[model samples]
Target chain A: MALAASGPSERGGGDNLLLATFLEKRENLVLFLAARLRSMATAEDLIQDLYLKVAAMEPGADVRAPAALLYRMAANLMVDHVRSAQRASRRDAQWRLETRVTLGSLDVVSEPAADDALVARQRVRLLAEAVAELPPQMGRAFRLHKLEGRSQAETAEAMGVSRKMIEQHISAAVRRLAERLRT
Target chain B: MTQDGLARAQAAAWVVRLGGDATGEDGVEFDAWLQAAPGNRAAYRRALVLWCEFDARAGDVLAELTAVGAQASARPPAARRSASRLVPPAGRRRSALRWLTPIGGFALAAGLALAVLPPTVLKPATSTTYATGRGQHQRVALGDGSVIDLDAETRLRVTIAGSERRVALAEGQAIFDVVHDARRPFLVQAGGRTVRDVGTQFDVRQRAGELTVTVARGRVEVGSDGSGQPVLLGPGQRLQVDRASVSQLSVVDPAETFSWRAGRLVYRAQPLADVVADLNRQFVEQTVIADPELGKLPITGVIVLDNPRAVMTRLSLMLPIKAVPSDRGLTLLRK
Candidate 1:
């Protein structure tokens, strides 16, 4: 009920939507890239890789949809980075054993910095408070879909409601959270 | 809605939709939306940051939240490893959240993000032991097309010969899809119980010396060593054997048991503590709930196995909870 005036508006027009879009959304994309990765360093590396790939593209090479293509390239780079990281981990495992990296223990994953973890801990409280303030149904919908990482369809099925309801609840929950969590 | 409000709403909707299996058009549309206005991207980034935070900390947030009017139950004994999870949660999904074990001290290094190593063995003809790391899953195809999907932190050995097919599931859980060869019986041994595949699809989960077998298709026979008490499980039938060697059979949807291999967790009105127990298995971080009452809250949905930290960030939003660093990965407290 609190989401009637919220959600995407049907509007699309020409506004120089190529490399310009990439520049405008670079910072936004950095947040996105960072979120998808386990560390800011990896995200930064991949974003740089993405820029190179874009710059290296041959000009006037049938670039049908530049903005869409840019985003897709970004996603592709992310996927590739993950695949390489996986391979490196396997190799690292073998390398650690060969070099006698440590004792009998074989824990390879990198640990998060204590300072970063502390900042995250504070942020979790702020976010959780905002979620607790939502309407009951809205809260549940957001929890199941957004927090639990369930699909909207899965959230609908779990709640015994329609997918549309889940979408509306999600939008409302996000709007409320953004408003409340703003510093 | 004001301009900012409208932008946040659209951004939120886009995040949800794009998070799911978005197509090429959605990307084009999203790009157009991004190019249309500058504020839209900032608003979207704000929403995205929160979304990312939740993905990272899913477990801790759940530990923090207290459901409205939920019973503020006392904490189960810390040493009672599986005792907390043994408490069957509310709803028709009685058999749901059968994590069965809530090991608070299930020691894992905190803050480390594990990358799931892909299943190494593609085709196995002889006896080979396949193992997965903590929070890792693998699907192995046998020399014969029979597939065995392994859950997180599992160890199993498989042997295939002309005479018979044998799988020794030493620990963890696996779903077996066997190709019917009447001459060679498919036998799986786990948690002191042997599950004989009478040409069926079934899942066997063994955690902390407790085992559960759920049959999805065809039939399976569960038996203890040297005992005539062989229990038969048909489609939708489940058999659970506890640490005390007590065996119980119940009706359950096999799909739920089969969900983990498919990269998602399916639960219906499962309690928060039990859900956290499941999360603990899939993550290196152990989420400890400060208030035991928070564990009573029911969670109904699927949880995509992203990293644990992001999930915790999101959990804080939906539940009355927050988290702090602890000896064990994270300690969750009420907001």
Candidate 2:
């Protein structure tokens, strides 16, 4: 049950290569799926389905380039989900937006220091301030992806920028936010 | 970059890279980097914590962005320049829908001026601030025939220039009936998001880190501030952007959303916590759910914005709950 082993050095990168690649990109794949599917919860579900797909792979399956195959598989799974989910979601478009996707179980409330309501509010204020402080382009990028839950591709499309640019902006945004909130 | 900055940047890059491309060489490289230095792992952990926080509180962050963005943009130049650094891309076309949501059934909050809607009266540029205290509602009529109904404990700033009609909802809820003057489009710059009217009537409510926009008439476009794909909401459609998360579209009865102006809060299948938060704003005395699980109870009824005691008494009969006197106000306990 070793979910991941370091690179190809550990036991000649045989059976675990695909699983390792899948494990490494699991979080990123969620983003990739979320952007296309417009739902984090669904993306998570797909990631699980992907894990099963990878886990069930023959141990001796001589697969060349596991990463590309893994992503392609994820993309295909996403298409399947989207095709099926479209009719059901649209027909029942009576849902609200409080769907809390526990990405890695980000237990922010577990912090002992900010236990009080006031401290939590102040922390939000700080976060908002840092985000608001970002330049318009970067700020919009952060809002659309982080705040609005748009995929980097969708965000790029919305901002009329390249997907690479959206990624860069998000990276920069995370860097800037971390720096500002460090204190 | 400084040593710490280098680590932070690398950490951010790894986190972001994983979001886009974490497989193949990228994954191996990241693994090597982590093992290469102790500081690298620490840096990555630090960035991850922050990233996770953003993911967890995405809704709150967005709402706060709107609430904070409203105030940041409205602050005097001295404060504004230091905060945002760059100005709003004024270069972006200001062509907006002048349709501010109108309070069709409510009177003016300031003074009962003209009961008749004002014609398209061109006026000198001015900025006006309208706010409501607890247990108070105000209807504000702008010169452009557009009307806004301010709910309790709401504050908004209205600035009408020769070219644009902008309202920043710092906090609270407001229904807008904007007049269709294409020349001066009505744009509501909330926190970090903008609800631009498309010759439509809509309600924009920003609370905590969540924003709910329900379009009652015509259509409105809700987008993150400055730029991004604006979500077009049509009549009887509601878009709820919960703290930096998903912009959930739902079929809602517009009457339920707009009923607040008529002195009754209409809710259909909303959580009891959401209902209580709304009540707390309307009344001086607050209602606290002693049981966190009790807050998740679905409430579907109309609550008159009268005294808290009367409202609670009526609510208790409808639901299995009892109100006990507490220091802050009344705590709702299971019967």
Candidate 3:
């Protein structure tokens, strides 16, 4: 199948076209990787890895089919990634176990300091109450955006409000709570 | 401390302590506020000391307050004194009550918090959804750049992450023109089995416990999530997986399965019942065959998506069937 290809001139043209096609389809390539990797960022990183592999391939290599070769390389990369992830997870688990003893001692010593903890509890409780007392809309916005860890833009979108409105609500909420808790 | 200095210090403390763990930006702001004035620095130091002191004893106080609050809320006004006995000393009782008042108010504050905070701060990392309303065909370009052409009244969830790309076909049919990425394997979960890609284009259709998968390019491994070697499908190969049995491999035009995405419906010697089922999803009025035997009749043709009435009229002319509008839907019967 490799020998059946036309002369050097035709193969060179095909290689150039294939390289362009690969570059043009980078987004599609990332999607393909993301679907398997389950993370878009990871997929993007893999695409870079794929590009480097493709770029390093020897020039004027007799290629029976370019698209098939591309797919073959991609398949091989996935197998290698899965093997490495398994090793990393195993190492992480071991590290967690090793550090547990040192961390445990710090926790034990901290437990005896009770008065400081009581005051902190009072402050948190006060803050929580102040938040709960806010108007329903303002309260929800604050909880989802502040406590729950959503972005201001995402919170606005979810609540069907503008980002500016979200910002205003948060500022007002903070001001009101600060005033109430001052006493 | 001067009143203004104390006020600024308190505000900074609230912003930090009540801000729910300090973020990087918060740290920067705190530093800036401290350096803003010498008095500000002194006030913050005092506030920080108070905050640290509070943190050390908060848990035990919170536990005690929780029990007292629950008791206070549960009992009648007459039973209130009984709950108060649970309170420790005079100072402890006053502090506990002070804590309870605010804690009770926190539930109200939670609602305010949602409105105030940024959505990204609370949103989960990712969520997947697949939806198709009546007579609607939708296409979704996933975050990964893969496009899913959903058949009418279909639903599916695409879950793409760094480690795996997965699509769960909850219902209906879809054509996937997958891009090959070797670092991540694309797998589609449909019906009772999963179809794992080998750099391929494919169509998976699931209806009433019957599932069919057709591959256009590369290879697909079709197997139940539980056991058995998956049936491998090369280009132009089709396989059916179901609870009762897996069908033998067959050569078929994979394009025919995907034609619906182009507003064309192609059927090869299919049962009238099956054709009606497909049409039902595409039209508002349901198509039904009154005669069971007539429903068993075979149908074949390419349906160009015109209006529902036009398509029904054309179907009636091509076959020995009539369309009757009923309360249930459009019924097909032997004419």
Candidate 4:
């Protein structure tokens, strides 16, 4: 529906239309997130966050196209999260190898049978091989983030790079791993 | 598409798949990039399907990985030493292999399986009934300030909220003098399609899957849930939307629609079955037809909704029919 630009009296009409559209399109936006996040619950949470952001926006400000603006905002939020995760991963790796030998010295005994252990070792070997095949920086970011559990900011600091760069690295890492694991 | 265009599409798909929880300005750039090309939208949709497939199997993969990790940890010190040795000094080389190989296999299978399955379908809402017996005209003020004047033997439910205001008519009829609230558009969901209010007064009546909406003032938008398209009705227009079909809009007398709220039931060539259906709600025992064909006979007049028996007597005087109590319910037959 084309929104007519009229006097202040007609502003109410515009607001009503906008609110209606928002309600109708909110689910579509959530579906958009769920497709990417792979988790409906997480997507729902993000939609809630988006709702708060959208609701708080100044109404008087001219939103030339509400749908496009909403999508743009949602996209920016996702990118920021990816970047932070990247940074966290890098920092985690440095911490794991440098200050974490306690697990190595543990005297825990095994409970599982030999066959299970053998199978596990093989899986880890497969996983290791996959990571090894990743592009250098991307692989490092994934390890520090996923395996080591470092904060994205810390990972970025350890890598001595911008947070955005770290996110890009992780995204590439995940894509490559997802592709490689398929075979 | 160019490699750069493809990359951006992939990134956008990831952002959406992640539920937009990812950080950085890449999501914004990715969105802009996706909109930049029609090809990008198509690629993103493909990636989205793959992402959903991977997501469904994420639980299984995580469980398997945890089991593997536990197994690795349980091994003797010597085995861990050998495993650690296999990890190259360059962490990058090791990480690439760690995530790529196993995850890729499961994700691809899961994606293909999910794609082959049909999309999920949502079931229609189960209806709840609200009815008033014969000879009783009740006025109900809804939560949203809209008032409903239920004619005798009418059944309806009012569901109102900030997001949506809906009324489901099970049987009988009601006159709605709806309060104007733009934020919450009022609608009567009955007979598959919804009679949506566009800041107007209207009356809706439903009987045996046959329903009608009469707009006295303002406008109404009528459309089925499956079809998003709506037919808008202006003031003084009456439309019949039923399971069988929707009738052409006819200019109606606004008073004829509002007469029920004023304690009078007005009928114009309406069936005996419909008149009895209206009476059943206003009266406890209800009027029934002895002959099946008699129920289909038409009647046209104004019945002052007062005493149930009095209305029935008046109805019998106008038509050659007499009311009789049967084992099932009240019955009416030719005199």
Query: For all the candidates, what are their Cα RMSDs to the real structure?
Result: 20.5, 17.8, 28.2, 32.2
The DockQ for candidate 1, computed on C-alphas, is 0.10
- Winning model by lDDT: 2
How would you class the docking of model 2? incorrect
Cand. 4 Cα-lDDT: 0.54
* DockQ winner: 2
Q: Write the per-residue lDDT of candidate 2 for residues B1-335, one digit (tens) a residue.
A: 77777888888877777655333445445656666766776677667668767765654555455433222222223322243322322222111111111122222121211132222222437888887877667666565546577888889999888788999999999988776557778899776788898777789998887889998778888888766688989988998888766678998766567767644576655688988998887777888999997887776555555457766776675567889999988999999
Model 2 spans > 4 angstroms off: A1-183, B1-123
lDDT of 2 by residue, A98-168 (tens): 32211122312233343574586678778877887887778878876775455678778767899989988
Candidates 2 and 4: which is better by DockQ?
2
TM-score of 1: 0.44
| Candidate 4 C-alpha error for residue B319, in Å | 2.6
DockQ pick, better of 1 and 3: 1
Per-model TM-score versus the true fold: 0.44, 0.42, 0.41, 0.37
Residue-wise C-alpha lDDT for candidate 3, range B122-209, written one tens digit per residue: 1112556867766666555443334456777788877776667888998999877564556667899988789998766688998788
> Model 1: per-residue lDDT, tens digit, B130-207?
998777766665544455777778899888776888999998898887655577788999987789988767889998
Model 3 residue runs over 4 Å out of place are A1-183, B1-125
Docking class of 1: incorrect
Q: What's the TM for model 2?
A: 0.42
